[model samples]
Target: MAEVKLFGFWGSPFSSRVQMALKLKGVSYEYIEEDLPNKSPSLLKYNPIHKKIPVLLHKEKPIAESLVILEYIDETWEGYSIMPEDPYERAMVRFWVKFLDEKFLGAAWKACWGEGKEQEKAMEDAQEVLTTLENELKGKKFFGGDNIGLVDIAANFIAFWVGVIQDVVGINLIEEDTFPTLFKWSEEFLSCEVVKGCLPPKDKLSAFLLARKEAITEAAKSIVYK
Candidate 1:
């Protein structure tokens, strides 16, 4: 058995974050694909509370949560540095990661999936976050300046999945004209060799998201009738 094992869902940006981190650090591990709806015994055993995927098992010790797993990967392995060595810069990375996960992503999700007034409000909130990120990227190639770091890893959804989902839903939030800097960053980030290797194929991802969207639409129609 491999010393390191990862339980992840293929279409999940969160799971891809851990994969990117492990690749960046040049760590060898076993990949365990999990069907989230029907989670495996190991995934349940490791993350009893959340019962979500992207769990990391290192030498029989399990770590849950993608962000937490990221830190663990950075600390446990030795090669490329995932987190900054500078104290203040590290703090900034953490702050941005929190903002992305807690504030920005929620708005982005609603903008893509929500209906009517709710989606409009979410678009406004998501745009504000995108503008902030565009300004932050003004003088840097990535959130980590030249290298891909914690914050960059954390923003996987914005960098890749957001565009795919927007296409599926026919909404344009992170376009070149609207947010040039962020759009450029997304292009660059997605072009990176490490990132390319880990991401699910675009066609497959789009199909998966489209199916989910259709289900939601049907469910909403049923609710309206009842």
Candidate 2:
């Protein structure tokens, strides 16, 4: 049996992050597709607390949470460390990763589900997050200096999902003029051979988001009718 196993949802950015890290590190693993709405017994067994996807099982030991799994992967794989050797540089990367996880992710999700005024506010908030990120990227090719690193991986989830949310919500927060650095980073990040090859198809992701939106809207309407 393969020593590594991954349980993930195809359209989940969290899952994508772990998958990308595993691939970049050249680790071979068994991939299991979990039905999130009806999560499999194995997935539940592996991640009892969160019951979430992107669970990485290494040598039969399970690791939950994408960022935590990323660190584990880097430490396990000796070559091509995703984090910097310098203590200060590594701290900077961790700082950005925490910022994106706590702040940007929620704002992006809010932008997706919000309506008229709420959505406008969400967009404004998302733009502010992007603006902050753009400023951080000034004179830097990647979030962790010249090469892609942990912060880049953590932030990439927002970049991918935010684009999908923008299409579904009919609003664009990462415009060229507003967030040029981030906008360019998105293109570059997605263009990497590993990411480009691994990404879920755009049409498929769009359909999934549209269906989710419709379900939410219908549920709201049903509540109003009731």
Candidate 3:
């Protein structure tokens, strides 16, 4: 058996992505929880560039970046393939993954930092992103068609984190009536055994985001005062 280990933070969606993939693939690995504010020496040494969580150690070799780690895991494990086999299909999956990563994923942080008009603008931007995804997922059960695949896993964080941000900022971009497809996907993704088993508790995640939003708001206030 190949030795596998994962370094991650509990509340980080990026880390949760890898954890979900690992569980789905039936790959057993040791999990080390890292404190992001004061990262462990091992995590720092392993991921020198980003010092980020969701680092995968395979046979004692560390691979950083959650997306890269997901690919690595999918390739290394044979039982369940998360990515599609055909080149064209694979490219299509990658396209949506890239879109979500580049556009929607970071908008929550921006919205958290903005105030008044800025906040409203950020929410609009995020809503547009969700609208795009909602349309794309209109007829598909998952991004990879019937079964959940790499794109679905890659974009899963948006489903989970958006709710946390919505709760923190009191903005709901993904209402059932407005973005029904996306909202349904969120429910299905969260209800998946692999995903449901691994997610951080709801209250804990909400508290974490609430604190993060408060800290960002306080920092913005300090800057205005200065």
How do the residues 1-226 of candidate 1 rate in per-residue lDDT, one tens digit apiece?
A: 8999999999999999999999999999999999887999989999999999989999999999999999899988899998998889788988998888888877888778778887788889889889899899898888888888889899999999998998999999888998888888888999999999989999999999888896754443322100
Tens digits of per-residue lDDT, candidate 3, 91-131, equal 88778887878787556556655677756666677788888
lDDT of 2 by residue, 1-226 (tens): 8799999999988888888888888888899999999999999999999999999999899999999999999989977678888888778877888888777776666666666665566667767878888999989888867777888888876668778767876877677787888888888888888877667888899888888896754443322100
State residue 114's C-alpha deviation in candidate 3, in Å. Answer: 2.5
- The global Cα lDDT (0 to 1) of model 3 is 0.80
Top-scoring candidate (TM-score): 1
Question: Each model's C-alpha lDDT?
Answer: 0.88, 0.81, 0.80
Q: List the candidate 3 regions with Cα displacement exceeding 4 Å.
A: 218-226
- Relative to the true structure, candidate 2 has a C-alpha RMSD (angstroms) of 3.9
- Model 2 ranges off by over 4 Å: 216-226
Local error of candidate 2 at 49, Å? 0.6
lDDT of 2: 0.81
- Model 1 is weakest, by summed lDDT over 10 consecutive residues, at 217-226
Which pairs clash in model 1? Answer: none
RMSD (Cα, Å) of candidate 1? Answer: 3.7
lDDT of model 2 at position 210: 89
